[model samples]
Target: MSRKPMLPDGLSSYLAERWRGIGLSLVIVVATIWLGVTGQLGLYIHPRYFIFTTVMAVLGLVFVVSSFVYRTPSSGEPVSARRRAVALSGSALLLVIAAVTVLALPPATLTSATATQREVNSGGLDGAAAAEDAAALVGTGDYERLSVKEWVSLLAQSDDPALYADKTANVTGFVLPDAADPDNVFYVARFVVTCCAVDAQPIGVPVYQPGWKATYDTDDWVQVTGTFVSNPSARSADALAVLPTTVEPVDQPSDPYVY
Candidate 1:
């Protein structure tokens, strides 16, 4: 008898079933490698994992490539027609979904939508530690150099308008509106990711800009430079806010997250 092909009708289901996992692995391997190569892996994963993830992906790819060269002989045990069809279709569906979701979607940093939904500064960022970090900058009078996170923490600790008075804040971040007082209070915000994008906590220096919505939309990156003063809006709960002297739209920073 002539040797049958590995994918002869009934046994084709076996190959599909066996290789479905491999197909999914291949998608992950390729996506991770490509993202790492393009310097976009930071969009999803933590920086610490960059080397490890890429290294493991390369190893996985080697296994996947080698597996193609050394195919195992298919078991010819008869499978019921219905069962065989289900296996083949299931594998195809899974592989297609994995490939499209992982490989086709462009890598992107988490946006302001995520910040708004999660409630900026709700994550347990330590106010005291933040205050300690900002202490050195306090005496230097170089307040414009303060970061959104540093300012948030310092403001959180004191909220005494006196502490921030006359201190100009020149900070850049995506706009995140204050949920309670949206029209008048919006944040010049950055996402603080402890481990990865998934754990990102939004921290911002509130900008009390009434009618800001008329000029800017949420997630619009801006550079705000002005002194912190008492929040002018009745609706905003923040005691101290940056009353911006210049709020100019700016391109999103190359790396938007604060690790």
Candidate 2:
């Protein structure tokens, strides 16, 4: 009878031991998927889905290579040492890539009002003013007076009445979709970029008051004077906030992009 093929002793065992790494890789993949679906990916170091997906793909390739190496026969040429070395090197490289990718990504906080403080301090009514107003409003217990839903409704209503009401305030941002009617109401938004445009996020206040369209185009630069209105049953009951105001067309100052 032909002798049974002698199997490598540690090969199977090594693969079993490395199963943990595979599990970890799977965890990362699942987490990436979850974040992408929930829009929570925008909260991460690299908010862009494509970036996150690329990093995950690299990791998956590493894991696949590891599995192949782990399953190779040990007795054929005793390449266990070389295989282990390669696995470790590959793992290290993958880790470095992930780290660098994350670090190099733009900071998602660019959309945050806190990140806009410098612009506000340097003679702009950007984030700093918004923060101050938000803080003051919150401090006076006025925030408790209206829910996020209420704020959206008040901002979406016909600006004709509000215009007559003389509701004028100041707001800063780029342009975006309107909360009430994206086609109708113009959104003044800012593209918040932490590191690059790849991970930039657009955040801003909605302007639906009369004459807003006349002064601002899709990407026109402008500073708006408006009033904050609150009413129940807006697009987003908890997050919709709008500013009904007269938009004053302004020059696109240097660094027009929020990033």
Top candidate by TM-score: 1
lDDT of 1 at 75: 76
lDDT per residue (tens digit) for residues 1-259 in model 1:
8665446664466566577877888899999899999988877776888999999999999999888677776676667556766787888899999899988877677777887778777764766677777887877878877788888878777777776666888999998898889988999988887777888888888899889999999889999999888888788778888888999999988778876
Model 1 residue 109 CA deviation in Å: 2.2
Model 2 regions more than 4 Å off = 1-79, 109-164, 189-205, 209-222, 226-259
Alpha-carbon shift of residue 114 in model 2 (angstroms): 19
Q: For each candidate, what is the lDDT? A: 0.82, 0.47
Name the lDDT of candidate 1.
Answer: 0.82
Name the top lDDT candidate.
1
Q: Which pairs of residues clash in candidate 2, taking residues 3 or more apart in a chain or in different chains?
A: 106-195, 107-194, 107-195, 150-231, 169-225, 169-226, 174-189
Q: lDDT at 24 for candidate 2?
A: 51
Model 2 is weakest, by summed lDDT over 10 consecutive residues, at: 115-124
Segments in model 1 whose C-alpha atoms lie over 4 Å from true places: 1-6, 9-11, 69-77, 80-86, 124-129
